[model samples]
Target: MALDGTGDERFYPGYDYTAPSGRSGGTLEVTETAACSASAPTDLAANATSPTQVDLTWTYDGTNNDYYTIYRGGTQIATNVTTGSYTDSTVAAGTAYSYTVRGHNNTGACDSADSNVANVTTPACTELTPSSISFNGVNTAAGDFSGASMVTPVDLMNLEFRVTEGTGGGAPFSQTDNFDANNFGNWIPSDTNTSNNWLLDANTTPSSNVGPSGDHTGGGYYAYTESSSGSYPETYWLTSNVLDGSTYALNLDFWWNMNTDTDLSCELHVDVSTDGGTNWTNSVWSRTNNPNSGDVWVNQNVDLSAYTSNNLEVRFRTISSSWRCDTALDDIVISGPARATEVERLAWNPDPQEASAILTNGNSYNLYARGTDPECGTVYYVGGTTTPGNSQAFTWSSCTETATLNAPTFSPTTTPITGPVTVTATGTATGIQVSWSEDGGATWSAWFANGATYTPTSCITGNVIFRAQGTGTCGTLTAQSAAAAFDTTDKDVATLTTTNPSPATGVVTIQTAVGVETAPATLTGVSVTIGGSSACNVTGAAMTWNGTTSRWEYSWDTSACGTSAAETTVTIDVTGTDPDCGTVVNAVQLTGVTIDNTCVDGTPSTITIAPGQTVGGTAVDLTTLFSTTGNVGSFTYKINGTTVTSPWDSSAYGTTGPQAVTFEVTGTDPDCGDIVGPVSNSITVNNALGTDAGVAGVASKNKQLDVTAP
Candidate 1:
């Protein structure tokens, strides 16, 4: 308050001193104070709820505070908001948000009125987990060649599966065993034995020369003889190929086995002729079984839809009331619903066949198998460019199968792997197609389609080789995978170095760094132990390796522990053996190692005795006083510290009450520094308590000491 008169004044009584001098006094009254009205930011809820985010929290106590203005749905969005909680990320998922928080007071034009309006409603959209339909199926089949019903190409179906395996001799019916051109005009010339009695002899256990269901292709069947001549209405027919029972549902399926000496006589028939082979009828599927019924293969299925007859001829008969019979037949599957040859999506320009992909030795790949058409079935037949006109449901059945493979069978995880070599391969299939070769195989790398990979950017040394070759559908070159070898040379590993940093006992120089390249990797073994005995003694020639460094010269003998003070801990084992990767051993160990020969006699042990009188000894030669400068060799006689190793008299310590004598003084010279004295002394033997030096009253506590050297 220095108003010109140099006076620091302070006395308030409602306008005086300065107002009275301005001529216009008496009317000079000022009252102005308006800006900090901030105190309205309490509670404003809505902690968290996400679909799009809301989380808005409030609570401010008014320190004249200035920032905070988050409103959503009501518009503002966020102005300053000096920290409380305001997430509101544009809110929108099931909408309904309304947050408000105000606390201005610092020029946003006086605020502090809107503090509670946080009604949130966002969360309501979270449902994701419904995807599955993967069937690339390389070999597809998982169920079809005996692996039952697992069609891939998205639903394929021209569905025809025929297997014969008959021909014990051929010429009874053709197509391997009749049925391809009608082979039964009725045989009976000498009782039928065209090839070897009509086929059906390979004998595969109780009835399967082969062909149970895997759609057979190589095993005998089809033998139907019934002619001991007891002939009860002789009948033998075998026909088929007039089809059209209305197509598509024709199912025939077969696989039977039989042999009858004569019981029920033998009758296995399934007929339906609309008068082409000249009338034949007897459906109800017959089979009699008797005559020891040995062979047992049995697998049948015949609906034929009741034969609406497009002249439908389908028969297989044999009726003989009592005679020597034999009736067999292998896989005959007729299947219906045509239109199914989609093999299973195959594309191989550079698909996945690269892992360990090496191919070239006899490389010749031209695999192409495009077979697609059963988007679902029934389509009657339509060309394909993208469905020209075919929609009974779906059916085109594109067909093409080509395969050829000559080189590809190299597998590698590590065949001397040191350089750039990432090879992989393993008998792959399912419309196969692969190609790879890294040099030894000559050249190839680009026809992949089955989990492939190849890595060869730099390193490849010595016998390095890799090969692979696989072509479609199991044909042409078929599929190969077997040539992988890598040998990156320059191998040797063993590291150990020592020249006596703090060792003792004697000669110890064992070095080994190992880099070996231009021939030199046979160290083969060298050791040096410690605690378990045998600490050095590897003399001349069993170790030296000079390609980079490898040596062993041990001879540390501490004389068994003579001068008392021999600290030890030395170990160094090494073994290198890698001559072109033959024995492959690379080891190195250096353990503990701190061998000091005990000889730096000094410091840390002070107990010069004389602390509480005790001189009634029968024996207590405890002498410890390390102060002669240096070089000490023996002196360790503890009584209460527990190490009594030299002429420890007093009859094994018996002069009772108060005995704590100590002494220590190591240092035999091989750098055995530090260990002067467990210098503590205390002895109160109080001996002399006996009863005649022997028996009687039994209190013979022996002691025999004299005590000197204080």
Candidate 2:
């Protein structure tokens, strides 16, 4: 190639060098191509399809793009999308996000600007209705639903109920200590090493580079172990006050910080005790790794829901093997859900969202409702009710019937009756029916009408027991009366009358009438005795029954019972015996009874009289002048028809040479009547006193005259 003047020069291919200018010559050619362009997507929009998903859509203008790139809050979330719509399945529930879309062309190595920003919020978790529910037979009104709002369709609903036998249920149990007051509120500190126990530190630990620089509550006091105060391998423990977890699920939350030279040289352990801190066998949480260097405070939550005891205790234990490890603790809390004796998860249901439960009579209960959202993986409480004050409880009562039967009454109040017997009784009950039992309630008769009586046909020999039975819906009841006795022995003879045979002679008869006989008791025999003599006694067949007079008769021969002339008193004894009533006796006495026969039948045969006694002078005795041949009892004398003494006195017939005297004799006889004999005699009497001398002269003259007459 060669150049010549000041104007432009051109070089041709395959030419030699020019003489004036030395230059190389090459071929020069020009080629033309089309330009590639892509536009940004427009109208970018995002919609929440569910609690956890978001859908994005936009309009693309150029076809040169191979895919769309998605950005969320300035961060690329997806690429290589061939469609205008994209679904983000990684979004969180109840969260807001800003999205933008861009078009990209991998072949042209270019990208369009981002589309307009799309802001959207994912749907919140689902909630149930009725914040509280309560109902019984009497209170069936609807529940309160003012506290619940649903952001998503509920995937699952459950209604749960639990009966609490305990008396613990009300506000939740909460115990929090922020360590801001420079003292442990309810926390107690213990340690194996007395000098290196847990102590309250304000803002910083005593040793450098091993513990927190400040408390978790910002410059407040915190409990920490002092590593510099004691030997290596020291242990410290901080225990909380007793708590009640028997009725509710509980949680223990606290903030802690640990710094150590080695990763696992120091350790922190959370332990629970149900025996008042005597033992800590349950270690719920533990950490062996240390907080590298910053002494960062980490919040730790330990679930105490597995424990159910009134003496629950929580303690934090730190074991340090070297002085380079130190641990600090602050803002301790012990709390739980509302206190309930029990919590039950009911069966899963999606429709209606209602259920029923049966509660015990004396126990209390609590009702709770929960709903779940599958999209958001959330479970929340929507409704609840409690029975701490007996708001929802049940009591039981029973209904049944009962009847009582009283003892029966007999027609005859007295026992030992002879005729038919009647029984009556009263019962007390609702719709009661009565019956009778005669065999000590072993068997019963048919039901009787109200106020009815039961009577038997014939009397029984032994005692009879009566029972009254009553029946109703509840059951049958029976009552027994005192036993009624019947008489089997003979009846007593009340009265006895006799017809006396006074002045009884030969062939005498005795009659006796006994008292009227009562039924079931009859008289068996009758006996009679006369004059207290066994010879006159008659009994059994000797006495006969007289049907007309209803009397007993006996034949008594008076002649056989020794005769007596004088009237005599006699007693007739009548005895009657019944097979039922044993024996009875009746006696009648008869006075002036003359029983005579032929025993004394003769009279006196002779009588003699003595001559002379003067009147008004010495009396003469004539007691032995009469004689009888048969049993003479006495003699009677009379002179000239005048009754005289035994000896007849002739003094009353003063002038008479022949005075008349009469005598009579009576014979003693039992079989015959009295026998009488009469005799008469004459006696001569001289004139008395002036005749003493004349009697002497007359006696001399009678002798002389007897001599002269011879």
Candidate 3:
């Protein structure tokens, strides 16, 4: 049948159409085209198979349609569905959807009405949960939270953990399975033949000389593949439950004993599956022969850090070529970097998240683990734990909270302090108080206000250490600063004096004394300076301690002061030190110091007399004639270069005519040792006439003759 553009039905040339026999005369009517249209699909049903997929099914009575079309929420999702069932993989997790189906003809020219509506909601994507959580580095003591209320976990590379409260110390994660319960625990054991499966035994395998003498855990159960009841070339597998590896680098450790025949081709394989054991494509470790001899068990470790999956699984496969091969496994342990729950991680923060509320004392806290998928961003809670609680809980106590206080500083940082000092503390805390400790911090003084003065009387000897403590509502905290040293031995003041204040040109003794003579003090050294010159300074060993006088005496050489005609004034300075007192100095001006050492030369260099005189007629006063600038003590006279007294006598010389006379005078000076002067006189001296006339008797006869001639 065909329809024209005018909506009128027409018969083809090769087909015949006839009306029923009851109405031959009336206009013929045909309803064949109206009844030949495709039938509508019925009983449509939609079901969500997974978070991202929805399976749809429907029933169809008529076969006039060539294909089916599916619509989700009034929108066409699939077309040309040849079968009654269709899968819509474009749905979203946790979303509600409405679906309907319709039948269509081969050319899509004729179509049926919409089928019954089907409603469905897709399940949410599974949340990732960690297999283990730890709080290894968290400080659980009171006041450790620093006023924080809520704790949150932090994501570390390949792991998660919480830092120490008020400090960021790292925490580690750990997990283990000893298999002492004689059961597989979370491990799934399977084999090609049921009779040849892996078994958990206490001591050894069924066959003698083919298995471990004992389990790795020492008198505990271990998993092993028994070859006694199975045929050759059989395979056995032991797989672990799903493990979450999204947050941590994981490692597997186990002890195994392979007592297999060296001639047989037996093998043991370790494999990993990322899709919950659907297919294991990664063969991490494999052993073709026995790793050790006898019944000794060898330890094996495998790293699972490369496979980061939420549904990670490990499997152990054993293939035995004969009954001589028996593989034993024990002490399986899984471990990774430390991990913690959100609350546990947050507890480790140094600062508080909220100041208004804090962790309650004596209250138990529950921990739960959760993770986000790096690939799809889906959150998965731990499979076996409740939403707010897990397998671990801890009780909090108020005793663990302590205030944070800093060390105190002293006003005088110099060692050997002798008096009281001020101590100042630095930090932030309520009701802060400070205390001090002496005796190397073994004992402490009473609490005082911040920056308080501390007087130490008992701990005056040796090294003294000072510490401070602060107390508040949270608790008490102590901090020790660098030590302050002190020495309490008594030291006396130094004094200086001189016995001869008005010293002449000679040695002057300067005395130095500390306090009283009997005082218990030691004079370490002494120095004295006079006339403000280095030449007159005396120090060190030059100043000798006089025990008899109970004083330190220094012989100051005044000769270095030089010669002076008049008195000289000078300043004298004395400095000394003692064991107790550091340094002592004294200064004084010394008056009436005379240093006269001047001598005068004679006024005349020489003296001469021209006329000759009789030897005994008169004595020449040569000492009176010669004069000098300095006082003359004595004079000596020489006539003709011969020694004589100052009053010369002519009788001493027989011949006396033009004789040479010299006079010498000596003088004394207070400073300069001595002075000398000389004077010369030329005079003629004749023998006295009566003493030497005529040369005795012969001269008398000649004189008689000469007298007669006169």
What C-alpha lDDT do the candidate models reach, one value each? 0.43, 0.56, 0.57
Task: Give each model's clash number.
Answer: 50, 11, 18
| Number of the candidate with higher lDDT, 1 or 2 | 2
Write the residue-wise lDDT of candidate 1 on 195-305 in tens digits. Answer: 223323343322223112211233433444434434454555556566655433366766555545334456677777766658677754776543233334445667775
Q: lDDT tens string, model 2, 1-710?
A: 55564345555555664535553455433232323354567688899998878999887554778888887644477998888899998776776566777788766677776676676877886544312222312111111111111111123434332223334466666778987898989999988877778888886666766787888747688988877756667778888888887766789877777656445467788889998989786457876542232356665668898888889888888888777667888889887765654443223233332222333322333333344444463544432221122223322112133545566676766667565555666767433344554443345577665445555424235445455555534444445555466654444544567776766667787887666555212455566766643234343434677777566788887665544343355566676664444645453544344454434344422332322322322354445433344433455666556667744444554433433333333333332434343444433344444332111111111111000000
Over 4 Å off in model 2, which ranges? 1-168, 247-249, 290-294, 337-366, 370-710
lDDT per residue as tens, model 3, 408-498: 7777766676677787777755555566545544455777888778766632465544445555445554555555667665444455554
Error of 3 at 397 (Å): 2.8
Error of 2 at 18 (Å): 99
Of the two candidates 1 and 2, the one with more favorable TM-score, higher being better, is 2
Candidate rank order under TM-score: 2, 3, 1
Name the 10 consecutive residues with the lowest summed lDDT in model 3: 701-710
- TM-score winner among the candidates? 2
TM-score of 3: 0.29
Give me the candidate number with maximum lDDT: 3
